[model samples]
Target: MPQSETGTDTAEPVTDHDAQAATDADTDGSSENGSVVPWTSITKPTDDTETLAAMTAASAAEPGADDMADASLPLDQVFAVLKNERRRRVLGMLKQTDDKLSLSDLAERIAALENDKPIEQLTSSERKCVYVGLYQCHLPKMDSMDVIEFNKSRGTVARAANTDAVYDYLETAAPGAEPDWYRYSTILSVGGAAALGTALLVDPMTPLPVIDGTVGCLVIVFVAYGLGAFVWTHRAD
Candidate 1:
């Protein structure tokens, strides 16, 4: 009776014009001059650009491998240069005297020291041995480490800017000196440990039940002794 409602119902059709209008509405929000602009084109970095930026950031974060090697070179050179007795003598001579010495003078003094003779009394052979070694080998090596300035043409040598680095490794004791700082520090540490142990056993302070004064004193003594020994051993000449 109601005109067969289900079969008679009608609906609007989606035509090409309607579809185009919907598309325009969707793109218009992001369009300028009737052209859609992609957000990625403006905001996203290209692959090559991103790779370069990553590389730059990495470089800033860490030192190059060669830099690490260079930093370690000086200490290694110091040890290597000091291993030879002649080189050690050269450094000693440079350190002791304020004036720059001629290469010949340095060789003469070192030869005399080596032979246990007066410089004036050194044999030509002994002097020659020292001279050749220093001139050909030791001086150049020291110069490379910046421990000494060697002017080959002038036949002169003097302390250089980094001489202190070499001096740090040099032993400070004079020949046949009694009880060097190292030995002295060891003895002091042992004595201190013993005295603290004895005091702790005696309980002289009558420590509280929960807090042992003797044990506390012992810890303090050992810490202080260790720090003192470290300072004594590593102190500059």
Candidate 2:
């Protein structure tokens, strides 16, 4: 170097004072612009975690899953309650009303349905039959299974949480002296059997062909009718 460059000869070191000044400048710049920027910009990174934690806490504070499970009625109990016609009628009555009923009122309604008579027309023994059955047997049984609430002391009854389950199993109408379709089908079967017997009797005389085929057709019709009747009788309302 013929002549050393005076200012460039040695570079100035980055001292702590300069570094602190630069940091303070950055802090000041952030504070100045902070008012214009959204708070969301500052808080966004942790927002997801905070929201997730809040949701988790809320769910944990609710009733446990077991509580929901316990509210549902058991299938066997539903079937058991439906096995008796009186209990099914009781459920039907309760479903129609929103209020609790006295056992006497419930029995009157059930007795009317069972006897196919007006409540006023029901004989004392008829009423008593329903009353005793409900008070001592049906109501207690349903109460034990949570199908209905039976207040023994108050002599009141009301639908419980599981009452709907019983309703699901109730027949729309009582099996009712065999369905008309069933009787008609039975009559038709008898007619067909008589015809078949006549045809067999005359088969030797007339030498009719395809008697076996006719028999097969009759069998198919009978089986189909029987299956349909079974399904109709057993089907839910």
lDDT of each: 0.75, 0.77
TM value for model 2? 0.50
lDDT digits (tens) for residues 1-237 of candidate 1 = 457777775888999999978776655346558677555555655699889999999989897664554454477787787777678778887888888989999999888776667898988999999899999988998888777899999999998766766787876548854225456557767876677677666665666432355556657876887787566534431
Report the C-alpha lDDT of model 2 over 18-111, residue by residue, as the tens digit.
9978766544334465544434455536578889999999999998755553457777777777876577778877877999999999888888
Where does candidate 1 have its weakest 10-residue lDDT segment? 176-185
> The CA-based lDDT of model 1 is what?
0.75
Q: In angstroms, give how far residue 86 of model 1 lies from its true place.
A: 1.1
- Highest lDDT among the candidates is held by which one? 2
